[model samples]
Target: MRTLAAFFLCVCALPLWAQEDAGALAREAGAQLEAASVRLAEAESARNRVRALTDTVHAYEAGLSAMRAGLRRAAIREAQLRAQLQARDAEIAQLVAVLQTLTPDEAPTAFLHPDGPNGTARAGMLLAELTPALNQRAAQLRKDLSDVESLRLLQEQAAAQLQTGLTEVQTARSALNQAMAERTDLPQRFSEDPVRTAILIASAETLDAFSSGLASIVEGDVGWTPPEVDDLIGEFPMPARGVILRRAGEPDAAGIARPGILLATRPGTLVSAPTAATLRYVGPLLDFGTVTILEPRPGTLIVLAGMAVSYGKTGQIIAASTPLGLMGGLPASNGPSTGGEGGGAERSETLYIEVRENNVPMDPLEWFSTEQDG
Candidate 1:
């Protein structure tokens, strides 16, 4: 009877042991799942950070390129001014020689000369003949002097601009180095369909066509979803701080109605995102220079063109206030009204901002902060 009781006790203990083992296994699985989730979150954060840094580096590079171009232009202008000054000097010297030769060395007196009337009459005739020439030469000299002064002023300005550009390039390079140092290893969220992307890039002739192709790909992808950006409109800041040089609907130099607002910004000025957005395209687009296109929401796109350099790859999501790129150069207030001469130190940069809804252009003023409206 005791042996039978022992067997029954062992049988009951077996089930209890199995149950404890199962619970332990379940706990282990739960712990692993939690750990994986944490790792994923960390990876996502790292990726975003790297993306932001990449964009900043691109912008700085663009700014540096612009500065260098400006420097080259300033140097050219300086050479031209020097040549003009040399020519003006020669002309002035010739005019002075003629004036000196025409003028009398001493005053004539009737008491000191026997042929006084004849001499006086000849003197008067000579003076009359030279009067018009003297006046013309004097006027020409005055105009030349003014021009020389203007040229001198322009040279000083150009020198200052060149120095500023050098400084900006140094600062941008340092910042770029720092950004690179902060980079972390992170897995990409989506695998790039190289074949499809290459085909699209090759076939698309215009920016609009390229944009359409990208939109189709984004929509077809099941893993990606457009972020809700409408709620953040007007709550964000402008990409860069600068004066509005031109507004939407204004006629540009090409006589085409501008679909965007152009901001005259300082050279190497920092540019950031106004709101959370997904980068769609970043590259050169015809006469627009280096362009960056972002999708803040589905069916809505924001275009930033006229950059010297661009950052970030396609499909990367960026947070608000993230650095995108820097402005290329300063705008020339004294230059022609048309977008200032390109690649010159005297010329300033214009950041073109355009907002599109369903591929149709819209005024960007309504979306920017009140501070930017002016």
Candidate 2:
């Protein structure tokens, strides 16, 4: 009897703690929202408004993601507790029935054993111990039910936070775009020659050929070369906050494979430069949408394609984490998202990454840290 009670206690104990964890996660989301709010306010007078706004947008994105994760956990835990309660209905009924048999009015008879007074005394003591356990179990059931209600209410209230985050992120993105257009402080390696770039694009029939000529299009006496980043090869952060939808050479829906990685991102999500590099070329190339070809080191080219709006001009040099552009998609709606935290393509837009050495394609995954990729 004690063992069974222990099992019930164990089950009830877990979900109560899980409820706390879920609430903590939600609070973390709130903290991120506060951070975003502060950053937004700071941007109003910031010398570098673009950077400030970018930070604000990232904070908002983090907050929204945290909110979704918390809500998702709450939903799962609520479902679990509900199922456990339903499954234990019969057991609880039996427990109640047994407790009734040990009530004061019935205890006299229950304590009367065949072995006389000694046996009767022992029976009474056993009943006394078991009664408390049953009471404790009942108390836990009440708390567990309360937890379920709380979780449901938490999710309901989260709708407001989620909407606020979405709105704020959109505002930040718009501010960033405006600031970028008005800005004139970036360093340039060479003055972009559109005529030469157009000629090269028109002459080359394949992507490789076009890439090979990207350097020649913006030829200049660039005495300064970006330092080598071979040591940071496997430590490079992802250019955007997203999930890897496809790895290099992985077959897609039509069984066609490419020598690059596909990252699925949310609408209007900011894409950043993974490292300091010179933009060898920026614009449409072949079938790839807006593209940015960066030369982080000699003989190495990192190709990022498929953004709605790509930033930087050809021959420009940018620092790590500089805003490259926003991914293609409409702003998020003011409600719960259908996307399960950047899990699928339908819920996100794709970013294609291809790395090359001496114009030979290489797997992008080999360059990015896999332990952090999801």
Candidate 3:
């Protein structure tokens, strides 16, 4: 009977041992699930970060594009104002011509007589009428002149603002580039997390391509040189004709250094090369809107600033007098052309010409091929 009892006790203990073993296995499985949950959370966090960074980059790029377009529009407005002023001038000239024919000499003493002195009284009355009319006409002309002046001023202000805007855009771009650099290693954090890693790679690749494209834009092509003009050995490139509204080294209203010459040119005028070589990079530059940088040979980079429009692309081949772009902004009907041989445009312009020999800035005046027309 005691042997039977012993066997029964052993059987009961076997079920309890089996239960303990099953519980231990369940705990181990739960721990693994918890670890997986933590890893998944980390992956989600990385993906969110990548998405945010990508969106920020896109936003900045869009802003830069908009700023460039705005600069172009502002330039066009300046041209339009010049045309309007010219029209007013032409009208004033016509009025002056009419006045010259109407009044050949000073009024005679007889015409001023108040008594009934034959037809002299009638002439006096006519003079009275003409006097007021002429005065009114003169006043109108003066008003028109004032308007033209104001418009011209507005154009100058706008151009300045546009330049500032361009600078801001460039600065913002630089900031974004820095931010991207700082976050360069953030993608690596996702390496162990497969889902996040995929997202990170995609975002990084997109950014990398964008940066590469920008870099390729800076590596310009050959520059064009003016034949028979050996004197412009170190000058920045310029159009064949025009004035410089803003000279290099001139401080702007805000006392900022305006680094390039702003050329004033006629609308639809052909802008030529200062020298001849291979065309290099032609694209939008920081604060310069549409620009063409020609690397004639290996060391020289001639930058054409403030294009109202662009016709070429990165790595495009161009020639001297080649139409890289239209005279951006408004082309003046009677206003000064900014792209000519003189100082910049007759109207408002902020030409930011920069000559770099092996990436170092040089004074453009040293190599100016033409006389100072401004």
Candidate 4:
């Protein structure tokens, strides 16, 4: 009976211990998930803040651009006004000189002069006209001075506004950085879910690849050109000489249509921006290692391909010729040492370039000018 009792007790304890273990794991997972959630929230918030700040900076930059334009306009207006003022001053001086040369028409003194009876009426008429003319000149001078003061005030106000906007950008950037730092603890907390974490990591990696691809397209190593119907827009720089394996809009060996030019480059060379524009998208595509889209100007899009390394972010405004990443592979040599076709192919890296106008694919070759026909 004691043995049977002992067996029952063991079975009961086993369930209790199992429940305890499950509960502990549940608690740990919950905590981890919560931490990750918080971190994600913070990251999103920081991203938002950064976006707002970027917009603010753009606004300020736009304002500054306007201010520069206004300044030019103001300068032109001021020059014209000054010219007018100078002309008026010169006229006044000339009039004053003439006045000095002429005697002020005094009431005709018949005792001192002969034939004075007819002269007084004409003299009175002349004096009336001269007095009004002198008053008008003085009023114009005052108006010109007032206008100059107003223009100066406008210039100062525009300058102050532009500066304030610039400061706001910096403030926003600092806030975003703080948020990012606070959220840095989230990844550690989520380490329990290796599968979910891997998914997230993969997604991030895909984004990075797409971003890199966008940069490689701008390098223009491919025999790139826009469609015959499109016009030249802009481009960025590329590192290491590369040959185009597949042209943009061309079919691959499997008859797969590609969106951008593909260049065989060193494996890990940095990519670069083709033009100054906002990054519209960064992510994966079928067969494409990575893809990135940039709107360099309004309605103009550039696509890059084969990018496994990228340095820019979506919605970010990158400058023309800015380094997106470094040459990402081994140095090229004369002999095909190991893996690929040409001597350069021994190191297998590629950069692809694509251009789009109004979201429609165009040839990149039309935009890029080079002494080399390639």
CA lDDT, every prediction? 0.57, 0.78, 0.45, 0.46
251-292 in candidate 3: lDDT tens per residue? 778887654566665333334455554445555444457666
> What does each candidate score in C-alpha RMSD?
33.7, 4.2, 38.0, 32.1
The candidate with the higher lDDT, 1 or 2, is 2
TM-score of each: 0.48, 0.86, 0.35, 0.37
Judge candidate 3 at residue 76 and give its lDDT. Answer: 53
In what order do the candidates fall by lDDT, top score first?
Answer: 2, 1, 4, 3
Residue-level lDDT tens digits of model 1 in 157-178: 5445434434433333344435
Best by TM-score: 2
lDDT of 3: 0.45
Residue pairs with backbone overlap in model 2:
none
Comparing 2 and 4 on TM-score, the stronger one: 2
Winner on lDDT between 1 and 4 is 1
lDDT, candidate 2, 1-374, per-residue tens: 34445654654554333435566688678778878988898897998887888788878877877887887887888898899789878867766676666665645565577889897777677767667876877777788888889888888878677766766777677778888888778887887777888898889887789888876776664645787798999888888878889989999999988888998887777888889998888898888878898889888999999998877788788888889998866634423343333334333689999999999999888898755422
Please, what are the lDDT tens digits per residue for candidate 4 over residues 1-374? 23323432443342111111112222333333334334333544454543443333333323333444465555555566667667556555654554453454475453232436455556555556555554544455576667667666665655454344333323333343444334322111001233433354355444334333343233212222223322433323332235566776789788977666766653333355645556555555545556666665655666666665454544455555444443334324322122122123333766667766654667666665422211
Residue 353, candidate 2: alpha-carbon lDDT: 91
Q: Which stretches of candidate 1 lie over 4 Å from their true place?
A: 1-173, 177-191, 216-228, 330-347, 370-374
